[model samples]
Target: MRTVRNVHARVIEAPADRVGALLDRIASDDDPLFPAPVWPPMRFDRPLGVGAEGGHGPVRYRVTACTPGRSVRFDFAPPADGHHRLDVEPLGPGRCRLTHTLQERQGPGQALLWSLFVRPVHDTVVEELLDNAEHAATGRTAAPPTTRPPLVRLLHRLGQERPVAVPVPDGARLARTAFDRTDFSDAWRVPLDPGMPRDPRAWRDVLPFPVMASEGDELLLGQDARHLDFRASLLVGERDVTLSTVVRTHNRLGRLYFGAVRHVHPFMTRLVLRRTRRRLALAAPAAGSRHRRREAALG
Candidate 1:
């Protein structure tokens, strides 16, 4: 069996009730998570509540059962013999999580193919679907509000879409100023070097967010809603050093939000380069080494 997980976030200006109504509409493909048509167009009888059903399309299968705000199960045959279950659950105050599992039955070859090839495609599809749902639920593209609305509670429900986008910053160039004005002081120079103990210059990307390099040990990474105070330091180990990073979401929006918080270890930054260089150094003959005798004997 192969499993995939996806998350989406958006900042919806609307009230919780407004968002909930929209989410209820999105539960089935007839309403759709996104405005556009998706491939295979999940066509099933508009389930009254939830239970078992038979369906057909690119794959023929029996949808064994389903729960409105919980999960859906399908048993596939013909084009593919497998069983799939789509599960949804709440994450936090206003966030939800979706998981899909696919298992091949009766054929080892099909199972191997599923593990190797078919799995990734399913993962990508689920991710895209979730993102589209996030965009739609958040009222993301709505024009900036001239006046902020009174605080409203958020809803977290399975099979329901929620907003994930942060509000646009005040000025058009706000993001740029934050980048330029960052004070690179003792605070910025975390003792950590990027992922490995290689060149400190090489590991900035692996840090937290995208960063700007000022000089040798100096670097800067952008901030996000989850962790506006994101910071990192380096820890040296016997063989490999680790990047110790910290971030706090501090949900200032007065509501819960969902999003991935990417992190980078200082040492991980140079891991690839260090590993490659180490391999090359080892492969080359050492000067007057004990191994030389073995090499000479082999020759």
Candidate 2:
């Protein structure tokens, strides 16, 4: 058995039909608003349509009922025993109120589990879904969606989890905003430094800590486990640089899992850490040899 959860929202300056169409089109392109919660292009069975089995994750649903411009209902698709409903009603000219409700079946003892375990996870998904809907209805984009790191947590089943990767501003080309200036492109490149210890064979052995990567003038950092976004450009002394990264954690089956962006910087960091450790090990013997040589000469 699953406890029922409901979330309601209002969409201003948009009619029910217009809003409905946007939701229908969500599977077509890579919506910037709902980057992580993506669904593959769908094939509809009817006019308030239902699509075939598709999408990347365990989350799936099929539209059970739809009244164009009025409401839509989606039932459990698979891997989830949940159903969601969306209702749109006119508020005034060029405006409408939208309501969304989510309900799921729970087995015996599920209430305790939901209250103690699943509430937070459900809250996040509901919140994120509403955020995507709101942002899509409005044409504007947040300069920085969030400055906070992605929420990371441990799960009973999955070690540590985070949100999937999402795009952020490219620091190199971004014009200076009043808020941020620490662009990634201009950030210090730790691995490239001559004095830095590096390992050619294994990256983790070289760079133990995380480092940033650049594209054009943009600095990008992302961790898929926590669903966190960090995009800030701080004016350091003179040059404008950007720091943008997302750490996300996804909670499933009462367990948390951890995964960072698999990219060049992380790769380089691992390599550098490995080689540096190796070099230190080899240098230790030489230091002893030198000490013995000096002592022998003195004798």
Candidate 3:
């Protein structure tokens, strides 16, 4: 059997004991390991020690040995013949490091699955976990990867589309209201809430370019920079909204930029949509009034 390995590590600002306490909390709750939609599959047949039964992700395994605030290892099954471990190493006083490794033996079929579907998702999620750990330790969010892979860059050059479905109350002015709350300029940099806008045209001053289109319940807004021709839209429905972004990479630079974000594109779309939904319902009346004023002006 060929042993395959995957590992992720991060330097934490917290002390060894504090980091270990965070790990213990994660083990007990599994919240950090598995966020919403990605459920943890640990079968705690016994306590946390050697021979205890549980599995991380899809690899079924039993505990090999566990040293509190230090290391915890698990042994896998036949197709996944190997082990996984999470270690907390003391870098020095007031500083520590965390490493999580998954080692398993698998055949051709398993390898294909891992390469195509599992690896990408796992990479993104693991990074998220590390970010969360850092946040828990220091109350600061970790910076994520700034670029995508080679293939993803090529795909970006050709073009790519991402759509997120977000549920919200349906109203006549929903589309405009949705746009009223959008600001993605610095979203890639830091965390900020950009909700429905009071004036769709207001974005013209904030963004580098002019307004693209602001229709009834559908707004197309973005800038066509030298790197890429980007257009983001809010397609409002009766009870839900589909936030979609289309990128037409202009040249190699555009493709490279797209490639950099391709991995995180899906999650970022969902996140923005989720954020938009929170303010959509609350701003319905304000949006309706604005829509009526526009109609009156046109008449």
Candidate 4:
């Protein structure tokens, strides 16, 4: 096994207490420091404190130590051996330094994976986190924003969330009754993140179909063609969004056309849904802004 250590530090033109307050909110709902939506938001099963259990995406860790606004350390879950930590230091009354360090013990395979894939993504995340820290504390980043390297961008795209096939939901009444006799029917779904739009109308533009009907949580869109008549449903639920398609054939020509199209339909549907989900997520308001809106509503 080999030991791997990585460190990132940024000097913020804010008091240590001010910057450290941002650190304390790391995995909270209103986190203003950890860059998210583009990257997965950091999450914990409970509140952000020692013993909290959760991690962003596939990375799993448990908080083993915490110093409130000053420092926190996470120990990687089983199958991975390492700990990563963040700390804040006072430089002066009006300035502070924030640092993140990651150390892990890796076998040959793990080390290779880290060097090629994990390192690039990890470094990018750390730098972006620091940039957010600077912004939240001083209203601007001291340095230019971190640009993701080509490999990192490619990896991120390839690793994006994928849609899963599901039975047509009963809640999609418009899609269910769109056609008198259905020849083909299918549905695909993807989870919605915290800040993602929840209204079905907001997702209507994902398909080129004309709006057929809409009710409650589902928007129905489709076109009647010479070969086949089809209906597409976009259902936005509390935690996920479902895209469903239904088709009806008029005759042999319709049957033949749909028979050929159905083969590629599932693949195309999943691809489109995944891409649109990511696009919407990236376009959502930042966590801090959303949190402020919620506070205003409550107030």
Task: Kindly list the per-residue Cα lDDT of model 1 for residues 217-251, writing each as its tens digit.
Answer: 33335455442444443322232323333344555
Query: Which stretch of 10 consecutive residues in model 4 shows the poorest summed lDDT?
Result: 286-295
Off by over 4 Å in 2: 1-3, 31-48, 77-82, 140-299
Where is the poorest 10-residue window by lDDT in model 1? 152-161
lDDT for each of the candidates?
Answer: 0.39, 0.41, 0.54, 0.87
Ranked candidates (lDDT, high to low): 4, 3, 2, 1
Best by TM-score: 4
- For residues 1-299, write the lDDT of model 3, one tens digit per residue: 45678999989888989767666644342233322122222445666777888665455778888888688887876656678788999999998888888777778887887787666655655665566566666655457532335653343323212233333323323323434333221221111111234343422232244447777665566676787766655544432345555566667898788888877876766555544433342333221133234446789
TM-score of each: 0.34, 0.42, 0.46, 0.88
lDDT of 3: 0.54
Error of 1 at 231 (Å): 67
* CA deviation > 4 Å runs, candidate 4: 282-299
TM-score order of candidates, top first = 4, 3, 2, 1
- Report how far residue 148 has shifted in candidate 4, in Å: 0.8
- lDDT by residue (30-62, candidate 4, tens digit) is 687776777887889999888999998899999
* lDDT of candidate 2 over 133-172, digit per residue (tens): 5555654323323221133122311311221222333433
- Reference-based TM-score, model 1: 0.34
